[model samples]
Target: MENSIGIHISQSALFNWLIIFFISIFGIRDVLPQETTIKTDSHAVVSVKASLLPKGLLGPIDISPAVIPHDQYPIEPQSPMYPSFPSTYDPILTGRCQLNFSNMASIIDKTASDCSAPLASLVGNVICCPQVNSLVHILQGTYGKNSGSLVLQQAAAEDCFSDIMSILASRGANDTIPGICSIDSAPLTGGSCPVQDVETFEKTVNTSLLLDSCSTVDPLKECCRPICQPAIMEAAVRLSQRESSPLDNAKIPGKSVGVDVLSDCKGIVYSWLSQKLSLDDANAAFRMLSSCKVNKVCPLQFKDPSTVIKDCRDPPSANSSCCNSLDIYISDVQKQMLITNRQAINCAMFFGSLLQKGGVVTNVYDLCNIDLKDFSLQAYRQQGCLLRSLPADVLYDNYTGYSFTCDLSDNIGAPWPSSSSLSSLSLCAPEMSLPALPVSQNSRASGGSRGLGLALTLVLSSLSYTQRAIP
Candidate 1:
């Protein structure tokens, strides 16, 4: 029984050892598959995370088998990448938007409100921006730097940007303030005045004067009234820009040229006046042409003969002796016409009055029947009437055509000689003889008496002639 018991125990121990070996083999197989799965999943998760990163952050570390081949996956050109670069951009927000004053102001106000900054700050920023800076330069070139500066200052000082916008909206895009600023300079701000501007101003003044009728009577006063002050100011500014001394002082460059310019202008004005008024009137008008002052500079003022005489209070007087001589000559002509029984006495009177009033005559019948005061007899002798030659029919159709000569002479100072006789007679001595009449009450009526009286009165009035009478 002891032997049998020993045998069973040994078999049981062998079976237990075999079962343990099989369990160990199955456990090793299961652990090997789990380890392989876990390793593969972790590698896949790492590759996906690396692919999700930005190209800038990811260096040259591609792990794909297809990408590892140098010939197939060659390096490609790439754009520069910066981590701090902005994600988005807006032109208006950056003050780079192109717009006019009104639109710019509106946009600026909107930007300021959105950014929580003041209107002044927004305007300052906008004006200083690159885009706006270009616009400012353009404005400066067109309207002048002084005007640009003023606009800049005004914009910066405004409490409400929208207010300026409204004002800009009301004006045209190209409209500018008149007389406040000119091209190349604005005199109010001590800016440089261009030579072209001065020339243009002078031309404008001259054109205006030439068109005015009153300029003939008082050229300096009438022409300079509108342009004098502005012209003077501009001249001063121009001189200052050249760093030149005063106009009177001779140290300034181009001083003589400037003086000549002013003198030429004065000459033109006075010359025109001389052609229109009598000598006495011209003298008086020139005396009244004093230079105007602007910014302490008097460019138009000069020491010339007329000004010197006026300053000395020795204005020239009209020639009273010449006037007396002309009066005597007129009386002689009238007596001769009366003795000759001429019919042209009324025509002579009409022309005589024109010369006495204006010292010149363009037409014979222009001053007929026109009342005149301050008639200068001396002036009448100096400048005679302009008479057009009468038609042959009119001259020869008269009753005295057989005896009267129609050979009208322009020599007003000397007498015209008769074609039939060698005797000479004054121009006022009519060439036509009186008509013969029958003795009757109707023939010597009121109308005939009035006509004779008028003819006689005209012959007795002022009558004189000029050596160079215009025909």
Candidate 2:
């Protein structure tokens, strides 16, 4: 029984050992492929995703593949991936886009109210209020356009207000006239305004000298009104102050100088009008001055000399014959002047000894009558007045009474006249006295003489010509 029990135990133990061996073999087969995949994936993740690692963790990590050498892979400097921020203070980005007109009007109104109140007691309520109101109207008219910055417009308005205030302060301190605001006041009489004061003020402000100077040279005519008007007003205020009486203690005139009644308050009215004239109006006034004739109602006098130029440009009346005769005389003078100025320097040098000496006036018109027989082409050429080859074609139209062709082809082999001497040449034949050269075949035989004659004619002409003033 003992032997049989031992055999059973031995068989059971062998079966248990066989079961353990098979379990071990299958477990290793399943785990081996998974472990290999994990190792391969971890190596690839480290190589490709290394930049994602934390800063401290990256030092211990070796991300490069074992098979690839570390030196083969170059480390490139990394640049930032986002754009840089823009400046906040840039004008294009920060400048205001819109303007508030109502707010601007309010500012102007406040400025006018402040300046006008103090001025009212001095110049009277009518004159002072209108001045400030006019300024407000001007500001609205000037900057009420669609475009322009509010900042710049405000600045311009402020400058205008400052100017107005300055004018008011000056007047308030100087104005001592009581009832001197009345238009009916008499000039030089105590508290009386000058009747001709308007006319005088107009004459002074629109002086012919000032008008002529401004028209030709003053580019600031558009802005001159503001500066000039105030000056005239101040002058009028002085006139009133001079005329004001200390004995008469009359109250301030309730009846202010009305627009239509300016003839009575001429000084003040003209002063105001001087500043408000448009460019067109100023030009018209200047034109009127210029159009004044010597013997006409508005003669060219000390007050208006511009009419002298006007008579030159256009006569006042369409039927006026004064300028027509004047124009002919002027043309003759200009032609003579041109002839004198154009004489060749070499020509002047050649004939300098032959010219009349002393203070006697030389008449260039007489130069047209010089005898060609006395001059020679050889002498002219020696003075640098001739060219070897023709430089340009001479137009027959430019030479009066000479219809023959004057170009290079017409006179080959002949030395051409220098362009610099053409003006001298014109003087030589001023009356076109040279007989027309023959256009037929026979003309070629005399071509040499004609060419020589032309040269001689020009030289003699220049020698004979002298400077003379036109009457």
The Cα error of candidate 1 at residue 381, in Å, is 11
Task: Give lDDT tens digits, candidate 1, residues 150-268.
Answer: 11222232222223223322321111211111222121112222222233334334434332433333433322343433333343333333422343233223434344444323333
TM-score of model 1 relative to the true fold? 0.15
Model 2 Cα RMSD, 1 decimal: 28.3
93 Cα displacement, candidate 2 (Å)? 46
Please, what are the lDDT tens digits per residue for candidate 2 over residues 1-471? 999999999999999999999999998876653322224644653233434446786367565543443332337632222111111121121123232334344333333332332222322222223233333333332332333211123344444434433333342211222222222112111113432233444443444433333333222232222333334344445444433333222312433332223222433433233234443343333222222211011100112213323342332333344345333332232222111111222223223212222111232112221111112112222221221111111111212311111111222121123324333432212254322322323235655434333431121212222224432
Off by over 4 Å in 2: 1-197, 203-206, 209-238, 241-251, 254-276, 279-471
Task: List residue ranges in candidate 1 displaced over 4 A.
Answer: 1-261, 264-326, 329-471
Could you tell me every candidate's TM-score relative to the true structure?
Answer: 0.15, 0.14
Q: Specify the poorest-scoring 10-residue window by lDDT in model 2.
A: 293-302
What's the alpha carbon RMSD for model 1?
A: 36.2
